[model samples]
Target: MQQTFFDLEVALASLPRILEGLWLNIQVLVAASIGVLLFALVLATLRALRGPA
Candidate 1:
């Protein structure tokens, strides 16, 4: 019973670290997505300006 309680406590304490890692992963993914979107937009704009060669 005592070991179970200790295990539960450790699991709860680790939750925040896990959440923080997940948040960081999400942030990095969002940043990469934004960068790709911007890059594509710029490429499209340049293509439009070139105008049907």
Candidate 2:
């Protein structure tokens, strides 16, 4: 008998769950990106004002 480190059967069985997690991660990434962009825009706007920020 031999043991293997990789199993295609097990991976295929969990594909749906894996894809669900991937989607969740993508959502978080997009949200974070928007938040960062908004923050940068605010900073840039303040800098344009030419006063203490």
| Number of the predicted model whose TM-score against the real structure is largest | 2
- Candidates in order, TM-scores: namely 0.69, 0.79
Cα lDDT of model 2 by residue, 18-38, tens digit = 999999999999999999999
Relative to the unseen true structure, what is the C-alpha lDDT of residue 53 in candidate 1, on a scale of 0 to 100? Answer: 58
How much is 47 displaced in model 2, in angstroms? 0.9
What alpha-carbon RMSD in Å does predicted model 1 have with respect to the real structure?
3.6
TM-score of 2: 0.79
Give the Cα-based TM-score of candidate 1 against the true structure: 0.69
In model 1, residue pairs whose N, Cα or C atoms come closer than 3 Å (at least 3 residues apart or on different chains), thus clashing, are none
Q: What lDDT score is found at residue 50 in candidate 1?
A: 57
Q: What are the runs in model 1 whose C-alpha is more than 4 Å off?
A: 1-7, 51-53
